[model samples]
Target: MSGAVPLNDPRFQTDPVELYRELRRDHGAVAPILLDGDIPAWLVIGYRELHQVTGDPALYSRDSVLWNQWDNVPDDWPLLPMIGRGETSIIHTTNGQHRERAAMISDALEAVDPFTLRQHAERLADELIDSFCADGRTDIIGRYTMLLPVRVLARLLGFTDEQGPGLVTALNEMLDGGEDALTGHGHLVEAATALLTEKADGPGADVVSRMLANRGDFTVEEITKDLLMIMVAGHQPTADWIGNTLRLMLTDDRFAASLSGGRHSVGEAMTEVLWEDTPTQNVPGRWATRDTNLGNRRIRAGDLLILGVAAANFDPQIRTDSSVLTGGNTAFFSFGHGEHRCPFPAQEIAEVIARTGIEVLLDRLPDIDLAVPGEALAQRPSPWLRGLTSLPVIFSPAPALSPARRP
Candidate 1:
């Protein structure tokens, strides 16, 4: 009735749905689990209970300062990269301060015109697709998915050529999470430090510039960390979301048929991906502010709480199948909820990027098919995120989109 499963266990990473589903069925929604360091945490897997925990900050808080494990866990614990963090993390902040920081980001994102966003998305997608479209076979991960998000984020942030790659690499390293995580985090801080320095001198019409001007009383160091959080949030998961959605389009028969029937919108397909294969399987950790109960499980003070985003989507508490009905499915935990909800609709952003890239490429090369069988496809081994390392596909060589469509 009570036990712990290793968060980094191979099956949890490689085949999470089946693995966590069993955890939900057997462990009853909230399963105490072990992180990489044998550190303890609770994994919330049921839809209703996850909502209960996430929506009520009075009971569950993201303030990492409340986390009790720090007393027992080492300062250099690997889980710190993903779970707990400094005072500046927008993702880990709460309530009024959370709203303040989120507003700064939301206002900056709102400044980017929809038309201009799409125009840049299409141009970037077209150019990248063209580079590999001629090869007749390509790895979508490198050529398209991984690069598209960073490119768009760079333009939105007003990053120069040098700054773009620096941000991307640093962000990737942080999320990639291994022996180099501390180094990667150092690089991210360095990149953010430089950007903050540049913006302070002579601010431009960009997200960073806007954030700097709008920040109420955030110190420069705090603003730098906030920017790093925004950059990583904007690019990494969205890139993975696109890749997961693209793979669904290629492999799922029902999804593939929708393209021929003209029955599915990019948003619809993207929603389905989020339901079945959320980009973030587990998300920013929450700590119980006081002793509480969640789905019959006693949550003690300072206990770590992780919403099983992917598990909640499929939990019997909600019907995922109803997504096929007309109006579209809204029941998803991919973007999270409550005071900490992602201000920008990540799916909408992913849709904008994926639609342009997928549509432009599909229009040019219509017959692209997976080079390997669907069964051969495998997700990379990370407990917190679901993503394909690559989706190899073959298609008849087609001429690149014309300059008019491209630029």
Candidate 2:
């Protein structure tokens, strides 16, 4: 309710982090911003506010009911049905049906033993390292880090390597809000259609097929969308975290040296990376279902509520000091909090990404260093996510390690 921030303002587009910092300082925890050409919404930054919103389903609804409030907005806007649909999966769905569906999915994901995941994660690490070892110079984002999780998820979902490219491309396009902002759903729909109709064959086990056989409570359509969501959400954030963590390690040499010293050190290093650079920078959105009090202010029924997970993660009150978060800590809001928290599978996946990912990179390319100055790197400009379009790094000791022999 203070100085209004137009989403088009250069600050909104360029430096969202700094913008959030200022908003937190000046506008209190909850501030409103108009994004997508004046679609009114509130941005919530204070940890207390986000916790309150995420914890209460009755007061603050994630259901698509919020979309109906935006009657002036076009029918085709991407977020419309999403809000109306409400928590479709465990992430945001609030309705009992969606919760049941999520429970089923959770049961399925939980069925996969932790030891099995560890073994698979080890194999995945080996394969990714193999690809990058030959040249010792590869784009970790595109070539290795990103590919591994997709491979694992595909195998889990019963997808193929051949399907990887299209699925990955579709996911990127769908998420980037590119090529189909109006519909914001073509890529996922296409992939889901193909996947849903495909025959189950081949020597590998498929998560989708498993779900098909024992889809506790999800409809075929819901199952497919949930699978797609899992695939997209599972990998990209982990890849970004891996990349960001690597950059952090290279940025602070002493930290890297300490991390490389031993196995336990790797855990510490992962914690540091998480704290320093959370993979997903955007907080999920929520809407006020009725008039409510948030941090001493009156929130109307129709007002948009923004959860600034990034800002909350950096809040001085929760953290010991802002300076320490610079290295990567698990305490960050890159994931989320409360009842609307991310799925258990996603958390396990992140653990795999952090642990196995860091081990592989260090074991294989121990001498890898940032090729450019940290300040010179270009970060992507989306308030919903934080990542580099491309990160250029150079491996020292020349020829680097061979693929077969890489750690």
Candidate 3:
């Protein structure tokens, strides 16, 4: 493991694409990697190799209990929130159980009216912009992009408006993969369980109630854990999607037209971001069920394989010209692949929230521009997700619109 690349290296924050290229050049499709505490694993950066791994869940399982390094992992491991052990959530479940849980989640999300979802996003976006628009300048990340998705998701999931801020803080800490991860995860669990308890007697038309009403025979504890998983999975990536796409539009010349009432370009910019700067960069990941050979590397039973999603999207074999626009191409692994990929309804919900949020912001502030040099923008240091820590911007001062005003 001496030559294994450290997944938590500081350089990954600044130039992950270059690092991924280096990993591919040195280690081919599957590179040996060390996570926090120098824990050994494999980074699958090849597009085809990643597809094979995700497509064959029987060989590469989502159950973290099968990981070989758990014996050496300390009790306070920061990644425990991300790589949970023995959790009953759909992310860890496989085969029939996973299918049933996935179906339940899809059903609950599918029940959401798309128009209502967009209205929530637009209103929330307006409110967020109102707080900072008159100032002519704002850190869009803190004030807008980071706040929108979770708030919208909270309302949809039956949580009150007062609960949204706390949920945001907890999710950020937990997904950050830092010292506060466990504490944040604990808060999330407590919140989910409390909400489930409250909704037990007075079920509403929200996601939790629908989940409770499902005939899956899942226990309350199981449902609670699944809710936590759904919230975590839904919020951060969608938030990043908005932030990353915004960054692309404000800084890249190709997307400059989007700022000038070119609404058609917005979708193109988003698709391009998914291929290049995807929110969920590296998923920590499937475990080897038995000894196997993949991408010319030897593997043993219980070996951990981190899915290099962004890396796979940029694999030179598949993307011969990374500079070209992606347009409607969505063959990327941003939402993942195979049966464990993000549920279709969940993806659609994320799209509605992200697309609506961006469109509203652009419609309201047509001249918004980056407030700082593009090179000055920094991404969060976590290896799991790629998102701007803050997107400072300056725009023409505008009056806050009334609730009756329509964009």
Candidate 4:
């Protein structure tokens, strides 16, 4: 089971849906798999069963401090950034702690008026398009999908453009669990500390400022962790969502002909990406609170569970035919469930960001087309996420914008 079931298995990585079906047939919905270092855990693939895991904090906990295996696990575990660190952040906490932090985070993020943030996103999108518009070619991932989010997130958090690159790079390495994970994480810690110091001068209009304004209750350390958690939740995942959404537009004949051509609207297309090809296909390291039965499997306390959002989204019992569409269903577990649902709902954040960003590209580069066959694209290496490492595209050249008009 360990050998065949690790998601890193070449066969499973190449075409996960096929293997998910096979696993369901053999092991039912809750299948066992191996993480890095051969650590064993359950991979919950059924929609119903996953809801049981993600929604019930009483039975399946999120706080890593509660992990029964905490002492045994090494500090350098690669998946640490994915779920273990930032224990005090809303995403990492449970019960009352999560509620308190959630309110704090919501108040801070609300400073970013949705309309203004969307406009800023479009302006950044246009400026990025201008940079490569004359060349007629660009790697969509590097230039558009990835870069735009870092800029927008930086702006929303009151960080300067100069600070964006370093912050983005560090967060990317941390999430990818790359060879430089420790270095990347350390850089993030430094960046967060510096940003906190800068905000200390006085709270301004950005999320960081608002978080710092709560000095009466919030600690500088907590605010720093809150900022880091926002980066973890929004930075790379948003970029990956944009890439996955556009990948469909460039490949699927329906969307390729016209992004609005299919029955799925831009919102729905974005949702589809979140469901069928979630940027993070397998959410790692959700620990069991105690001996619990998920489906027919008895999971021991502290055993990590990989919520197979990608697998559960396609569970045959809930989804009869996903060949055509995904998302909008209450059953879709893409954004997660219960207290951990993305800070904003599907239409609220990911869809709005991706749809608005895509609209900007479609309007500015109307003639854009995929540079390579979809099958020719290479994926980033990870046991979890399924993302195009790069996406090359070509379009009719356009003139650069005047600095007067550029954001």
TM agreement with the true structure for every prediction? 0.94, 0.86, 0.98, 0.93
Ranking by lDDT: 3, 1, 4, 2
**Against the true structure, whose TM-score is highest?**
3
Residue 337, candidate 2: alpha-carbon lDDT: 69
275 Cα displacement, candidate 1 (Å): 0.6
Pick by TM-score: 1 or 4, better one: 1
lDDT by residue for model 3 (222-263), tens = 999989988988999999999999999999989888899569
lDDT of 3: 0.91
Query: What are the RMSD figures for all models against the true structure?
Result: 2.2, 3.4, 1.0, 2.4
Candidate 1 regions exceeding 4 Å error are 258-265, 320-327, 345-347, 402-404
Q: Which regions of candidate 4 are displaced past 4 Å?
A: 1-4, 10-13, 259-264, 327-330, 345-347, 404-407
Shift in Å, residue 190, candidate 1: 1.0
What does candidate 1 score on TM? 0.94
The sequence of per-residue lDDT tens digits that candidate 1 reaches over residues 25-122 is: 77898888887777788899999999998889878988888887787777776556777555567887787888888888788777777788889888
Segments in model 2 whose C-alpha atoms lie over 4 Å from true places: 6-17, 75-92, 180-184, 199-204, 258-260, 325-331, 396-407
**Reference-based lDDT, residue 351, model 1:** 62
| Model 3 residue pairs with clashes | none
Maximum-lDDT candidate: 3
